[model samples]
Target: MISADTTPPLTAVDKGRVTLLYHFVRLQMPAVKVSEPTFLTHLDRTFRIFIPKAPGPVSWAAYLEGLYAVDWLVCVGCLTGQNGAWEVLFNARTGRSDCLLVDALRARAVRLYPRDEERQDTAVTEFWGNLIAPDSAGTLPVLARYDGQRPLAPWLIRVFQNWHLSKLRQSGGTTALPDDEIALPMDTPRADGADRWHETFIAAAREWLGSLTDDERLLLGLRWRYRLSQREAAKLFDLNEGTLTRRTDKLRDRALEHIGGKLVAEGWAGDDLEGFVLTELGSLLTDDPRLSADHLGRLLAARGKSLPAG
Candidate 1:
């Protein structure tokens, strides 16, 4: 029997079993969630973001498990540190091993928690080395033990930095919508206010197009006329993506507001813009691919010309 003062020595077979469990646990860690307020509060403070913000109450048990995985990743990183001094152990049957879930935990940590450059470089170097090592057994056990001891500061920082970088690339240093090709929900019911807004949008588009100079016309054509995504349009016009996005949003908002006012001018007195007729206008804007100010002008002119005189 092992003495009370002495730690039990793990045999070679026991070590091998533990190593296998370590990998298994790392693989499974991502699925865990932490819902307890205390744990979540701690995670929020560490990561600087509220996680898994569900529309309603979340499954707390699952959330707690996720937090546990975070704790485990820190330990694993320490085990695999440059001066690792312990063999990571695992018991598959008992479910105590956490290394299997490291991937997802690492991913989340990097995404939610931005870290300093120096620490990130070191952790990344260690992670890659362990991943490609000739014999994983030696490294995996050591990594598992390290992560079990430390708080996952490096991993969280790396995750946040990567997420920020990705957003920058996707937006192309501009605040414009990522893509011009939007897929809106089809189920949204038309309201009177929406209808009025639509009609105003069409009328305003016509009027605005008439006011544009030749250069402005060409730029507008390159964007809305050619149906280019923001990035594509930005490249054509030599404009920044974020700037273009902001410009478009501002333009759209102003146009909508103007349209709402136009309804009042037309003696539509419901006070709400929703009751106005706008279905045709919205359809004209969204469904037709060959939208041009010239084409729209011609269409509206034809409609006005066909109307009967009172």
Candidate 2:
């Protein structure tokens, strides 16, 4: 038995394993030169972090290899300096790994998050933005636990989906409603109250529109702002005319649904709420020459209303 004061020597197998890991990391990050002693220290620390969390005996190695293969080390290096994995490993001692890793993952998150054409009727651009915002530190920790068993993009998508679901559950689900189901009471506010209500309604409408994806915004701008025919707009976007028509109809319905929810929450339900949303949206569109009053008129007409003349 070894004395308590004496350290055990590394076995041949252990030494070989260290040599393999050193060469693997060096090959992956040729630009980052690290002394053997520094590398050995980082390797020990990395294993301590990785080993208990690994799924199998071989998983830790697989994860390290996969990270290198995907150039994640290079990305971390670029984020800190051009020094590659050495910078990352050095900074890891200072607890900067999460920040560097999250920064590296952000571009992939943006690319993988569900967007306009992917989902049937929701705009997720703002959802992605909110997930990556500085206030979302709770979400960033998930990156450290990524085992590299799957490609990073798909893994990140799954994480985002779960985060979105949790957010929705916490917020009591989505605020949007079906168009036909949105009926507001017809009571009109007095002249002085009308101005205040109109201002409030306009603010809500702007907020809802701002939440839409860029593609959704562009589609609205093309159809309403530019007054393009369905066929003309379809050709511009290289989409089939029927597809564009359906997409535009869904967009309008989504807008109505979002605005309707806000009104109901504010205790302003009934025909007055419907009227307020439509009238204010129309008025807002009228301010921009690019947005056609006739287009707003047509949308209002579908809901059994007409645009108020200037």
Best by lDDT: 2
75-173: candidate 2 lDDT, tens digit per residue: 333333455553543333111122332332333233333342444123244433443243254543443444333333334444654554456558785
Q: After superposition, how far is residue 139 of candidate 2 from its true place, in Å?
A: 53
Q: What would the per-residue lDDT of candidate 1 be over residues 1-310, giving only the tens digit for each residue?
A: 3222222344576555444434544465533332244332333232222122322332222222223343454343333342221122111111112222233333333332345455445444454444324234444332322211112332333333343446546767322222111122112345757666555567765565455454344444445534557896565446799977776676555545566566667666664454333333443443232243333333434434211121
Candidate 2 regions exceeding 4 Å error are 1-192, 286-310
Backbone clash pairs in model 1 (N, Cα, C under 3 Å; residues 3+ apart or in different chains), count: 47
State the local distance difference test value for candidate 2.
0.49
Q: Compute each candidate's TM-score over C-alphas.
A: 0.25, 0.31
